[model samples]
Target: MSDVQINKTKLTYDYIIVGGGSTGSTIAGRLGEKSQNSVLLLEEGPRDKSIYIHIPVTYYKTAQGPLLKRYNYQRSAEQTPQHEATMVQAKVLGGGSSVNAMLYLRGNSSDYDDWEKAGAIGWGYHDVIKYFKKSEDNNIFHNKVHGVNGPLGVSDCAYKHNLSRVWLKACQEYGLPYNPDFNSGEQQGCGFYQVTIRNGRRSSASKAYLSNRRDNLSVETGCKVLKLIFEGNRAVAVEFIQNGKKQTAYAKKEIIISAGTFGSPHLLLLSGLGPKEDLEQYGIPVVKDLPQVGQNYQDHIEMSLVYKLKGAFSYDKYKKLQWQAVAGLQFLLFNAGPATSNIIETGAFWWSSQGKKLPDLQLFFLAGAGIEEGKDGVPGGNGCTISITQTRPESVGYIKLQSADPYQQPLIVPNYITAPNDLKTLADGAKLVQSIMSQDAFKDYVESSHVPEKPLESSEDFENFVRNEAYPGLHPCGTCKIGKDELTSVVDPELKVHGIEGLRVADASIMPNVISGNLNAVTIMIGEKAAELILNS
Candidate 1:
């Protein structure tokens, strides 16, 4: 049978899922499992067909290339007055899961427990761990915390750079223990990251869940959702544009907005479901006066400490044409080589201060420098970077509609490093990175610091360095957060939009607070839990 296409003939479905990203794809796939219901998934971007998305090492191309949407944002005036930063988000079908480094980290268990304490009822660690296990198909672990038959594949890196292994050893030598699993409720230690890859191919949400051809599921790409149609206090349909033609699709059961942190809140504001004053200014008809629709934004901010390497040992060696050809040939013939590595294979978690019970800092060791955009490599061409991130930032930002026009991008203000603690934590993390590099394990490979060019001997110097160099971690969350009421949050614990029936926001936007690690794994767990909630309802 032909896949169902969005047309005048079929304008209704049992469920309408906006955005074919991680959570949206999971919900649509789960709901479409039942033969009694039909699902329609609309994605604003094109299908996930790019070659850079599947290759593990080449994912940086997609992350820095045209597949992403860049938003120019400003930091808080008090912290860095008039300072502008660029935030990039995935704009493809599978979202970040398709473009990310594919690290499978669940963060610390206390992160979800803290969520319960913060008004996200039934979202505690114990309540949510099952969902995490349900979404994971681990290749190494088979226990209560991991699942063996799940759809998403989690495995060790097919190829690891020698520098990554050396870095791991250096981390252990620097006083951190070697932790085999970071997802086992405790997150402090250095180790290799298990990625979302299988047999040298990326296993994105679309690949894990939506790859099966199901008659009940209809996925439409390049469909931009303009607004939601409502009756009284209930959402009934969605108005979108596909191939430049305006169309309306009614929902029989519910309309889930899984458009991610920025997209979800942007859609709500466009549909007039935000603060009354803000909506009125945009000339939009107010449907619900939810004050916190685009408020309480949170994200992780990181600073990279780049160092020059003594020899051509890092992945930067592949910058030459001959090395690229050799690696490409190995990948094509045997599916094994440097091309199979994600580059960011090893990392660690630790506390910035001595008293903290949980680790406030996360570190990623990149074997090559100048990999990400806007970052500079060493002059001699061989380098490495130790990116230190302030895991839980107190700095909050927001996303607001620029105008009433749906085509215009939203105003993103990620007010990063406004919190004093965040800056101090990152400064301390930089000291720790320097300590790790100074260890005897890295003595043979280390040349000199490329970023600072001088030793940071005092607190003021580290703080100054952080102020000049820290950047967004690109893990945006908590915008349309889940909370006790509509005044402070957009969705409830059940992922339902408050004060509006038949509507829910099931993406990272619903996170009460940003977790300590990457958002992809936890976001997928949210999708699994959301599917269960919808199915049980």
Candidate 2:
């Protein structure tokens, strides 16, 4: 890998990858493995050197603090409690893998099969399962479904809170079976989530794919890619700003954009690859006129039900001065403590009231309250949180450019709950979690509800609560979806942008639909598969 800064006039690589995030880092590392191929990875953020980034529990700090860019978006105005929302996107080397909760979920088999049926050919569960297994290094469960020797680490939470066991038992009492492994094809039960952590440290994509650098791969930090440089329909270079100077990098073979869901479409539109009218509105020339560049947005919308516990059983105990010091000392000495766990340990997948073939609702039993809602440290007293989300939402949104300026943020409208069924699904999931909390397993730890003051007995009441309190589960995707044609898709099944040569997208943006669970693990699989495709082509 080329580690040093080279003059742009004399520099050209075999491949140039935009956005040094999860997929981009993986592509760079894989392409660089062969000594003959040279790769260049450009990231808009700085290096991943924050002390909080490596620690597992400190994701609360690293994922949302200075390392992330807070993007403001608008929800459906027709909804009861229409309001603006803010979501954080990572601005570091590892991207979401660096800032996420580290829940290593590959989604269910049906998720990938749905992709193939939706025109993402060759991406069926039978075909993509190999890529998923190829990217994982499972610490436990040595079955045909899981891989034992890969770069990314997958392990059980090092320090599962006792309250997590109660959560699982409560789920069992509610009729949900115990699932030993969610990644092994079946995903209809409760269990402790496996995390992308090893030895009590976060195993981010950068740590897995970009560590121990190779002489053929180079990464440029603080380089914001402005646009793709196309030569008569073929992408040949990219223009970016690095360290206060505009620079250009040429690619001899191909240019890949793995700039994530929002970043990818934003850059594409800025480069005249989107709808002709939209580009004309921004006083920019049109190139491909692919109206679908920034459309088909999907995300998992979640709402938390908080309950104040009877005893100090939550991770809130760390808020105390003495407990904080003890937790710190324990981690420093033996890498074992509450700090070693992601806190949101136990989770389940279940069918909603309107039962579907696959599970439609996802549950997260966090050991603390208001943690994912962007609160500092822990909230006041001992409390736990249960977040309910719709696994496959039908609400589709779009992204539009705010202006012609490359630095300006885009207008992101998730259009959540625009489909009435999407609204009903989440409301039902919330009510189901409330029933689980009322079971006998939680009797000893039960207290009063803090989020929904009164019981959500009526559908109207649950819908209102959902509208007023729902937040993005932080898994925005499909802004640059893959399909068979340009009329309904941005990229093709081979992961190439429609009508554009020597350019491809290999990230969550290329997903035809949002997967049923957390997107980090599947995004890594896309990276692994993208490298294989490029190498063979």
Candidate 3:
């Protein structure tokens, strides 16, 4: 199952792709398609062979299991008291796509348009839509806006809990539109999420892009990249450790870093490509004095509103051993059942009651309670959860190296809710979700409350609840953003490092801003586009 051979420590390739995650796997696959160029992908984690990784419902287990590397991930001490957000960075071949809820969401078009306005020229919605279409193969949604034939499998959830429709109806009652598609450029609506699932199994990045391996590609899992080998200002090679042994890989054309939002910046600092002060503080030599290497961190912050259901309409019935057996049998025999559905199958994107230019808040309606924070345990009876997340935040954070050693975890300060408006927006979102769930359509399903425990008497109480309970939405990005200048960004429009030659970054880490929804689909588009950039270069 391991791709790294102990005897093969030194090698050469046309492209060296670091971090075999969502974007890295895609780029490696595309580059290997023609066999004209050799591509090498190095992943810090093991191969994606775990059964839990393939089951759509076991995503929580993947987060808590050995497959994920949990970091210190502390929040801003100034805003919140003592709390660790515990960011879940996947340690597997397929990366977050292997461990996530598998919701296939492309952020609003304005997300990319805003990117272009913010210095990433040629990355506007119209320019990037082709790449998104190039990677997707939608099974149900057929339109000029969506692709029907592509490598990545995109399908509607096979099974939906009966209560999901009621949830949608409740959203309608709350005045939101009932749009069937969320990825059609317009995102203000409530509907069932089309997921990255195929034939009742998880369709991860590795499954989609690396399943049919090409002879020209070398996928080295369980290999931790130590640093880059720089000749003057050019990154010519990579140094890594595999199976307790040191290894080196040389790239002839270019080295593309796709180690995700946190890992990418961490690797850059380790390779002497960060701020001179930080490199000196850690006793590491500085190759480029890019002060923006680990700055401009942005992420979605969320809080949950839980309610106990009056009937057994939610997936809570599956908690019984008997019901579990039935659902497993159905999945094994027919590739259809509650087991195939990621409980977060339906949600909404809406502006606050006060309205906005774009949908700034997102709601994930889960047909179960205790799913958000698993430690609470499954509800004794039927229950449901409505989680509200702020998609755009004015507050920014940073990532810094804690030590010179690559094994040591970096210091990640998301600095959540530092801006007063950010907090106020989330507080408003909290009230909105509470109101939507309290709609008459959910009258029969409602029983009681848990997180808020009771009605919020005032706006101050809601804001306090949000401040006390909100956590990172796990969509961390902008650590190594793309821009026009080195002083403000890490990568250029072509995704190349600001001052380094033969090096580029192709991951969420290069995103100038965090989008309004899940990040996996856009990350894949980044890979597809990076391949085009490299092949043309």
TM-score of 1: 0.97
- Residue pairs whose backbone atoms clash in candidate 2: 1-214, 1-215, 1-216, 1-217
Query: How well is each residue in 489-518 modelled by candidate 1, as lDDT tens digits?
Result: 889999999999999999999998999999
Locate the minimum summed-lDDT window of 10 residues in model 1. Answer: 1-10
What tens-digit string does per-residue lDDT give for candidate 2 at 184-232?
Answer: 8899999999999988999999999999778888888999889988899
Better model by lDDT: candidate 1 vs candidate 2: 1
Candidate 2 at 292: error in angstroms?
1.0
Please list the Cα RMSD from the true structure of every candidate, rounded to 1 decimal place. 1.7, 1.7, 2.3
Off by over 4 Å in 2: 1-8, 78-81, 375-380
Q: Which candidate is the best by lDDT?
A: 1
Worst 10 residues of 3 by lDDT: 1-10
Off by over 4 Å in 1: 1-10, 78-83
